[model samples]
Target: MSQSFAIAVVGATGTVGETLVQLLEEREFPVSDLHLLAGRDSQGHSLPFRGKNLRVRAIEDFDFSQVRLVFFAAEASITLEYAPRARAAGCSLIDLSGALPLEQAPRVVPEANADVLDTLSTPYQLASPSAAATALAVVLAPLRSLLTLRRVNVTACLAVSAQGHEGVTELARQTTELLNMRPLEPRFFDRQIAFNLLAQVGVPDDSGHAHSEIRLAAETRQVLGDSGLKVSATCIQAPVFFGDSLSVSLELESVVDLVAVREALEGATGVELVDAGDYPTVVGDAVGQDAVYVGRLRSGLTDDAELNLWIASDNARKGSALNAVQLGELLIKHYL
Candidate 1:
């Protein structure tokens, strides 16, 4: 008989959290019992899984000991508050919030940093990197050996869904009003988001870099296990509703070979490389897909050592929920 275990999904009402539940069912994970939990405001809601609706309960009163594994899919503060409790109850956890310190949680992307899992003991705790980093890592991990990697610069154009349901609603409202020629008022975003791009995703620090940018760089390096690697990241809010698009430039120590790079990417896991002269876009290529789509592979006109590429990925599903579930799968297979 196959062994099954009890599992809990925190923030079960949110976008990523709901997707986590769906993937768990779609992948046929060995979940004997599933607990859907959220804050008081979200309590009483229900989510369907395996042909049944599971009622969401309040996280505060739930006993962590009942579940062997828990997914922290809510905001960072929620994870900060409850993760330790889960840990104290001997429940292994995977955090998607990027709240816990790297030294403590240690980010893990199965494709790039599965080895990191081997270093940890039982009751594993891991972080699923940001959407940008996850996509970058998946595309870059296989290429690390092909090139003498020096620096990577990325401009991530993310969909409004990155901000959660409110951002989605705001975009829809703004777009409808604009189409109807109604007066526009910005709410969720600082300025217009319909048919527009906000250069920054979140508030910028005194250094003028948004928090998302810093997190992208830090998380990418951590997952790649190359702390000293130079990473320049810029996250912009795009008006789109779903996928994330990235423009990546890599500076290598020696001249890059386009043939070798293409072959490497084509053979890489979790990657779908498009043919030359063709490009992948969020709507047509990446949304709702598991693979990270890469195209527009070319070398710098002046700098032979530079390589540039375009990436499209599904941020909500492939990036956040799926990765966290993969971490749970990894834990069950070995560490747990």
Candidate 2:
């Protein structure tokens, strides 16, 4: 007997949103009735799932009570407006947008924090950690258990696609225009992100931290359950179409050998250890992959009690949509 249920995918037009739909089908999520919802402009759109086309509807007209689960792939503002309404109508909200009220909703990374399942009294749950934060959190999970933590410093080279489909298209368009010797029009991004790297992922605040930096720091700490975890973040938007990479350094309370570190990483779920000769890169390795491919493991040069790592993963998959779907599986097993 196949157990099936009604599911709604809000924001089906977005990249992460569409990825979630694919993952849901790929994972065989027992989706008996699938509802695709998007904005007014996308109302007539149709997306393929399991070889059939599902018509898209305006989300403003969606009836949440009819669905058992609502996966919100919409913008934070849209989620804010409707998540509560969906919950009020008796549906579990899989908050892929990372916009849920943090204190009220448990931010779940199943590989790192499955304990959230034991305390699942709330209707809201987070399906995302900032890609930088997700990469950092999964890597840190094994280390946090082995050593007393001190501080973590990371620089994330987020792909241009992190901003959405427009970001990807803009990079392509600009590259073509530059090759044709035309003047670049910086529209989607604040700066020329065609062939160059922007040191900050968003406009800086008074504290000199970009929006990505702040989100990475705060979300990393929250996901790790370490309020005092000293996280210093530097985020840059790299000119790649997909995959996100991170350079991470950690100062621990004690020394850990590289061999043991490798063993721990290999044992961790949603993580994979790269061999010494092969370094993990965005294009060569991580795009379309589910594992957080990690390499460049070495003893910290300056400090004996520290370690360094280079990590990469598909920002759209393991970082966001896949994590959400994995959490949804947990939600079904424990609560639903």
The lDDT for every candidate, in the order shown, is 0.92, 0.85
lDDT of candidate 1 over 254-287, digit per residue (tens): 9999999999999999999999999999999999
The candidate maximizing TM-score is 1
Show the colliding residue pairs in model 2: none
Candidate 2, superposed: residue stretches over 4 Å from native: 122-124
Candidate 2, poorest ten consecutive residues by summed lDDT:
119-128
Q: List pairs with backbone clashes in candidate 1.
A: none
lDDT for position 166 in model 1: 93
Task: Please identify model 1 stretches exceeding 4 Å from their true place.
Answer: none
Q: Give one digit per residue, the lDDT tens place, for model 2 in 1-336.
A: 156778899999899988999999899988889999988988888889999999999888888888888888888888888888888988887877767766756667777887867866656455567777887888888877687778888999999888889999999988998999999988898878888998888789997888778878888888898989999899998989999999988888888677888989989988888998779998988888899989999877777788888999999998888988888887776677
Alpha-carbon TM-score of each model against the true structure: 0.98, 0.96
Looking at model 2, residue 150 earns an lDDT score of: 87
State the lDDT at 64 in candidate 1.
99
Please give the RMSD of candidate 2 to the true structure: 1.5
